[model samples]
Target: MNSPVASNESLVSVENVEKVFRRGSEEIHVLRNLDLQVAQGEFLALMGPSGSGKSTLLNLIGGLDRPSRGTLRVAGEDLHDLPDRKMAEWRARHVGFVFQLYNLMPVLNAERNVELPLLLTHLNRAERRQHVAAALDVVALSHRAKHYPRTLSGGEQQRVGIARAIVTDPTLLLCDEPTGDLDRKSGDEILNLLQALNREHGKTIIMVTHDPHASARASRTVYLNKGQLSTEPVI
Candidate 1:
């Protein structure tokens, strides 16, 4: 399975984390006192039913949202401590996100879409193109660089999204139901690509998925229920 041994140098560590939301005069707790650690180079899967707070936990790790309480340390930075602007900057540099919807810009071609995150960096135009090309090549989509999202198939579009996510070589790859919208064949292709990224490229990935088949590919699977962890990770 190539699951990594637990160590102190965890890439992601959530300690006593809790999340709550309020509407009008009522308060709802979403997550309660959760703790987790994902070692470097590990591919961890979070699985649960709808509204189980699986995505919420993924968001906290990806720096897309803040925890209402507790500490979130990812890639050695305390995400809970970073200000909004700094968090954005940190996310740009350290985290890559892949969504189920293949959030590509309809107006932009594949290469341009992959180049979006690099624009936030100090890379020049030429450098950005080089990075974009490399990323597309990694995903075996170099031939589709000039194609727009609307013209590509669902799997191809998701490949572009994957390319976009990895272009920056971020420290962490966060995937939220990355293959949710694809056919079984296409979803398997994407999962294979993600597996290659983890095993070959040594990318640290945390994926949220409901498919047990998909979760089976991960090094470990953790289940969440009712906004709380229901069981220890299944190997």
Candidate 2:
């Protein structure tokens, strides 16, 4: 795989990474010696076709899955070497995820949903509440704190998802097609929020997207094809 331009202060460093899955007797290769470097405070857009291993790569960087071969480092920790339990702890502290489908619990109100990640932390109830409030405010959804997911608009639910992701103040934000399900206007709103998070708050973000408009919001964009990183999309 070809390497993108290197960063001086890389928060994510993927070197010769490979990911594979097994289905019965068949071996599926999803990533092939991929190499990437994401600088701190950089908002990177990862573009690829369906089944191009974009989400798989995001999963690896976020410590949700392990690479089959080679080094994977994020926020200065070697994810490839961590045990499952340790990896879980590391991920909770260092990674936040925004899914394409909102992924909010139907029963929980906005604030409660945002507070979920803090539940795994050592913070007390009051402390968690403080964090949740600040996060909701960041997303401009404090007014909807008591509103459940079912009561909110598609865009509003995504805001809640963003709030939940940032409540932990994670080292990296791994977003998988975060705006895919929203309309153009709503998608722009989410992109604006993400841009503000990167520029004003210095949050490092890696977004997997198929839309060029979404990718255009990023500081840098890279393409993935056949499990390899490239400067141009493979056709």
Model 1 Cα lDDT, one tens digit per residue, 1-44: 12222445898989999999899889888899999988888899
lDDT of 2 by residue, 1-235 (tens): 1122244768899999999999999999999999999998889999999999999999999998999999998987899989999999988888899999999999899999999999999999999999999999999999999999999999999999999999999988999999999999999999999999999998889999999999999999999998999988668
Residue pairs with colliding backbones in model 2 are none
* Residue 75 lDDT, candidate 2, scale 0-100: 85
Misplaced by over 4 Å in model 2 are 1-7
Q: Roughly what TM-score does model 1 have, to 2 decimal places?
A: 0.95
Report the number of the highest-TM-score candidate: 2
- Give the 10-residue window scoring lowest on summed lDDT in candidate 2: 1-10
At residue 173, what lDDT does model 1 achieve?
91
- Report lDDT (CA) for all predictions: 0.90, 0.93
TM-score of each: 0.95, 0.95
Which ten-residue region of model 1 has the weakest summed lDDT? 1-10
